[model samples]
Every structure is written in C-alpha cells, then in structure tokens.
Target: MSSMRLTGTPSWLNIKQRSARPGGGDDPSRGPQEPVRRVWAIGGGKGGIGKSFLAVNLATVAARAGWRVLLIDADLAGANLHTCLGVRGGNRVNLSDYLYDRVVDIDKAAIDTSVPGLRLIMGALDHTGMAETSRAQREHLFQALRKLPVDLVVFDLAAGADRATLDFFLETDEGVIIATPEPTSIENAYGFLRAAFYRRLARTMSTSPIRDLIREAMDRRNERGIRTPADLFKEIGQLDRGEEARFRQALEDFRPRLVVNQVRESEEIKLGFSMRSVCRKFFGINLEYLGYICFDDAVWRSIKERQPLVLAYPQSDAALYIRRIVHKMLGT
Candidate 1:
C-alpha cells in the first residue's frame, strides 16, 4: 500500500487507520479466539544501541508474517522510527500535541506507512514538557491501545530509565532491552533493568511499609562495599519472611528479555550469556537472553537508505538473527 505522512491527519482519523487490519494469520474459527495481543515496547538505557533499528525491523517482520502491526514511535524527544522506515512527511500532530492539547486525540496522530500490514504513530518534534506522561494520559493510551484491532503494537521507547520510559515499558506485555557488548552498555542495561523492577514494585506496593525497608536494604553496601540488589533482598529476607516471599515472587514475575546488539565477534556474542548470568547471580533476577544481532554492514546500509534491514535484505545475517528473535518471542 502507499505510505501516508503524519503531517495533516486528525488524531482520531490516525488512530482509526492504525487499528485497521487485513487478517491472514492462523485460522480464527478452528479453536478458541486468540486474544488480540498488541503492544510490544522496545527500550534500552543507552542510545545508539540499535533499539530503533530492532524496533522497525521487528515490526516489519511481524507485519510480513500476516499480523497487523502498529508501530508507535514513543521516543518523543528524539523520534526517528519514521526515518528508518523511509517515511516522509512533517508530522502535524505528535505525542507532544496529544499531551499539550486537551482536545487532541492520540489516535488521530497515527499515520500509515508504505509497508503492508503496518501502521505508525509518530512522536512530537517539540518534546518540551512531553518527557513524562501523566498517569491519566498513560491510562488513556493503554486503554485506547487495547481497543485497537491490530494483532501487534510495537513501541520504540526513548533511551534511558526516566520515569516516563520505565512506566511505558511496564505497561507493555513484553519489554526488550537492547545493549551492546561494551562494558558501559552492559552496566547501564543492568541498571535500567533494576530500575524498572524497582519502579514496578514500588507501584504495586506503594502503601506498604516494607517499601521503605526494602529501599533502605537496597542502599546497604555488600562485603565488597558495593551496594547491590541481591544484598538487599537477602537482608529483607532476614527481616521479614513474608516480605521476602512477596519480593521473590515479584522478581520471578519481572522477566525482561535481552538483546545483545552490535556484536563484532564470537566473544562479543557470548557477552549476552555472561550478562544474563550476572543478572541472575548479582540481582537474583532471571533475564531471557532473546538473541544476538551481529554487527553487519547491511544494518548501516539500511540505515543510510532509511529502510529496515529485514526489509532491505531479508536474507542477510542480521535479518536471520532478528527472525530467530521473532520466533523465540512468538513461541513459534
């Protein structure tokens, strides 16, 4: 189909188009109705870690697989998914407009793209007070998202663990954290994961007195004098068995998947496993190592051409790696 720009559409119209779908997945009548499973968010603590690249290509592959997809560029401050998808058009209404103007509907801001089975909601260029979405707005967005008919909605989140990003990440059915093999990226990825868990726990137990106790325990330094989450969990376990059980249950439930990007060598690819181990050993958290995307020139070429690598070179190594990830995610 032809690609449409985000420049002049009304927010409601945008949402309607994005929610439209041409169905062709597994047979719908043979068994129980598969619940509409839209809304996947892609995020990372560090920038330039291939989060957006993965987001675009993942959406492309999902759409190509016959699942209607709505790709939301939730990185309001630095939205660029449209560029990666080779979309052209100045967005008239973005996430910023929806946030600032009470009358603007977020759905109206969404636009159609050239890729069949895929649609997009662009982010605002002027992100001036749009960093943190209010609780009401977030609820509105999620409620609206649930009503959409698309089979999959992918959000390309802004980098970092800011309150807004973390909140959005928590709202999704699954979250994918992207990181490179570099020490800095690895550390930041861990930090982001911890922060996300903490935020989620805080929200779930906002009224609990143990919240303060857990926070204080997390602040303590270990024998090596390094403050760590595991140390805090152990201390909390000693202090209150019930709280510890709750904490462990929360940890077990917070399964954030990982993607090690930009791997140049076999050793670099192994970093994904190493990082997964560190997360389990140090933080008592189990992270699913989704898969690795090796460093490939085709990725750079696709970026230069403003296209998704999976679309530009479907059979390339990078594309294969991404497809493996998709299979793992879908359990197919």
Candidate 2:
C-alpha cells in the first residue's frame, strides 16, 4: 500500500489507530509531527467548466493514493462542494463564519468525510458580504491553513478574476485554471490570466512611483496603443531596466498551470497547445500544460452517485487522465 505524510492534525479527522491518550487524561505525550503540505487553488474565470468537479475528484485521487488531503471550498457565494462530497448535514461554521466573526477559529469548522484519508472545510452558504475579506483576514486564513495536517490542500475557488479571487489564487503555491475546448471558455481563460497578472503587478508596486507609470502604459488609451500585457512589458523594457527586470521576474514566477476538460477529438485536444502558444506570444506568460480529460459517461455517473470518478472507475480513461495530472504536478 502507498503511504504519504500529512502536515497538521485536522480537528475533524481522528485516525483511529493514531488517536490515543498518552496519560489517560487531556495531556498526551509528544510524538513525531507530520510534514508540511502544499496548497493548490483550482479556479477558472467562467462557470460551468467543472472546476469544483475537478477539485473534488483530484483530492479524492490523492487520498486514495495514501495522502491525507484537505479540500477547502473557497467558493463563498455559491458553496456547493459539501453536496459534491455527499455531506448532507448542516455546517455549524463555515468560511463566512470565520471571516465575519474573529472569535471563530477556522480550524474549528473542519468536517470529517467518509473517505479515510480526506477531510473538508466547507465554505459560506450565504457569502454575499463574506467575500470582502481584508488583507489581514486573508493572511490570517493562510496562517491557519499552514497548520492543517495534510499532504495536499486543494482550494476550490469561485469562478472569476475579481480582486478577491485573484488574491487567494496568488496566495497558493500553484493555481490551476480549468478550461473547456469551447471558444468562450478559451477567451475567458485568457481574460482571467490578464487580470491576475495585472493585479499581481499592481500589488508588487504598491509604494513605487513606477506603479503609476506602469498603470498608464497598461491603459488602453495610452499613446503606445498597448492592448496586451506583452506590449506593456515591452514598453517597460524601453524605459527602465529595473522595472523591466521586475516585470520579467513576475512573468516567469507567475507560471499558472492549465487543464483542458471535456475534450472529445484530437482536434479539440490541440486547443490546449494553441492556448499555451497564444499565452506565450500575446500575453508573454508561460503556462504549464497539465493534460486533458476526455468526455466520459462514467464521470457523469460518478457525479450522480456523489462519488469521485477516480474511485468509481479507477481504470477508466478519466482516472488515468487525473493520474497523469498528479504526476505532472509532482514532477514525477
């Protein structure tokens, strides 16, 4: 059997074999600590592209592979990830509760799942005002997450490139942008990347005079007639070497990964590569291609059953596709 180390002890999950009172009281003997885990945020600009579906199944697959996984439903406004995981009870606390009430510690809100190696942190049901988290709140949430025990933490983010969404996306070690083969999905994905890049650059220059200059250069009405991020970077290179270096480093370090879903034909698969090219040429962004998932009836069936496809059909093409993605993400 495969086994992987986890980071922190989840409040919800109590591994039967691992839970023992050392002194037959509240105090317990100190033992070995789990290794810190990596956090990944899965998002897409447009809705209905299967972002939640992908996030749930991916976490399930990781759990099956013997890695303790914590799946966070970061989609505040329309948080349905609980339903996807077959959690049918009321949540005492959620992301909204933590955001709105400083007294509520987010760790107290985690929920155990039927799966052996997986746990879930539900998001806000009515997140109308909860999405407006200050920078301090965001940092607080991240700090709390760093203490969670899991080999992998996946955040199923809302579908958009709004300031809040972009902030959370940038906070994670890696972000996965899910897109379909459709034209609209592709266009929105590009727009999402542009917005994220600009937001990061704007934040990076919070106290610098070059911030205004960069903003003007990126503006559509500028004399340079720059419409794309590549054009803006080119203009910066001509003006100041320091600014150019900063811009280039941002572009290189902000390498977001891509996953093409619901693909059918070989031609449709080609769109993934074309997107990578367009991103490099027009946007000057290098995106890691994480592979594609073919349209499969079994996937829909698994969803209907409220189970992950990797568990329902381990040998199916869709499961294999997910395995490849995990491999790529792990660089194995």
Candidate 3:
C-alpha cells in the first residue's frame, strides 16, 4: 500500500518501483515479473458498457506505441479478454490455472498475444465465479503484479460497484469508469461514484462517530439530513472536527477517469460534462473526462470476426477514438 499513490495530477500514472532482484544485482529482467508496474483498472457500474473493448484497444494501442503492456482479464465473472485479443485458450495459462495450482507464480500466467509487445494474464478460462476471490488473494495478486517487468498493466474489471470491484479500482495506478449515454447507465455511474466516495471513508468511519451517521443514512434510521456526501461531512465536522479533514484527505487519492462510450452524435459526447458535474455535486468528487468514443458499426464487425478493432480496421472510427484515449492515458 506504500506504493499506492504516486502524486497529484498525472503523477498517479508515473508509478515506478525498482527493487533488487533476488540474486542482488539491479537487473530488471531477473525476476519472473517486471521491475515496476502501472496498473490501469477499467470498470463500470453496469454490464455491457464496452469495458473489455476499451481495455483491448488500449492494450493494443499501448503495445503498438512501444510500451510493454500486460492485459489482465480481471472480469472474473465473464473473463473474455482473450477473445477480444484473438488469443486462443488451447495453449495459454490463465489466472484460473495460477489460482488452481497449475502455476504458482502469476507472471508465468502472462503470455504474448498476437499484438506485439502485449501480453495477457487472462482470468477464469471457464468463468466459474472467480469473483469470489478472498481479499487476501487479491492482495497477493496485487503484490505479485506490481513486481511485473512490464511498463503498463491494464485490468478489465467486472461490472458493478461491489467491494471487490472497488478494491481493485482503488488499488490501481489509474482507474477508468466506462459508461454509455443512456439514462440507466448514467445513473449507475453516479451510484458507482457514490459508493466509491463512501468507500473511501469506510475504513475511517467504521471506528469513528461518522459510522453511525453512515449507517443511519444507509438504513434511513436517522433524519439528520445526510442525503449527500456534503451533508454527511458537514455532520462529521460537527461531531469530530479533525476527522472531517482526515476523511477529506482519504478521498483525495481517488481520481477516477470517465469515458462516455457508444456516442452516436456530438451532442451525446457532452454527457461526460454533465456526469462530471453530477459527480461533484453528489459525491463531492471531480472526474477527469478522458474522452468519448463514437458508436461504430465496425465495433460489431470486429467482435463478430474475433479481432481487435484497432488491429483489424485501424482506420475505423472506433479504432481512432481508442487511440486518442490511449495517448491521453499514456500522456504522450
């Protein structure tokens, strides 16, 4: 956890950890994994929001951009990132293999895909509920992954704002939340931000007097006007003066990037602005709208052909949009 937050602004993505190899030299290639790691976890509030698609293209684009990329199919429920990258399951070892005893080291699960400089550590090959991972297992995974030799690690997380998902989202160097322009999708996205915001205070509130306010707020057991984070914090400042500042500082580390996908018109693209405004109002948070993606027919075609849009049709609208996002993420 000491290496969790890099700094303010884009310093979050500049995480670089160097450690002595087991043998003693500063050799970066001696370990089973990378010397340092930058994990970008892609998640959303609801399902079918193109999380995997965005993840695939980002990995492909970053790989083509000359960075060693490792894409993990962290979508434990339906781990299908391999299909997007066109990596067959016959010969490759997945996270299931590592978790089930086929491989002890997580790095050994990484395999080079068709995309140059890109590799994958796929999740449950059979998709038999890998989401039930214990926190200890996730911690172990994080520790092992942070030591990888790769430059970037992209985790395609599962849907919803569950604790497991939030933990993964928080642990990463960068967190990306994908949402469409639909009303339901937008509401879920807001719900996710609310959950993440409260989650930021959870560890502290569990013991502080803020715990009662949160519990009453959740159960409607109190009429303290704690409908929003701002209201709750106002109450907290009255209850424990210094804890309010501590709680605020805990939330400062959470800077999740937003992406409005499936946009058909320029008007729909502005949903990011509205969403960002809503996040600030409801959760007292600011979202970095990285960019938007147009809804492309070629996306479906790529899915049908089991090829990544960035590779199959580089000039396609979806491919270009994904490239822009990748560049923004890389700060290049």
lDDT of each: 0.74, 0.73, 0.76
Q: Rank order by TM-score, top first?
A: 3, 2, 1
In model 1, pairs of residues that clash are 10-108, 11-107, 11-108, 11-109, 12-108, 15-107, 39-153
| Candidate 2 worst ten-residue window by lDDT | 14-23
Error of 3 at 61 (Å): 0.5
By TM-score, who's the top model here?
3
Query: Candidate 2 at residue 66, lDDT?
Result: 68
Model 2 pairs whose backbones collide = 7-150, 8-149
Tens-digit lDDT string for candidate 2 (96-153)? 7676674376667778877777888887777463257787877788787777555678
State TM-scores per candidate: 0.83, 0.84, 0.84
lDDT by residue (244-301, candidate 1, tens digit) is: 7777777878878888888776667667678789888878777777778878788889
Q: lDDT score of model 2?
A: 0.73
The candidate, 1 or 2, that scores higher on TM-score is 2
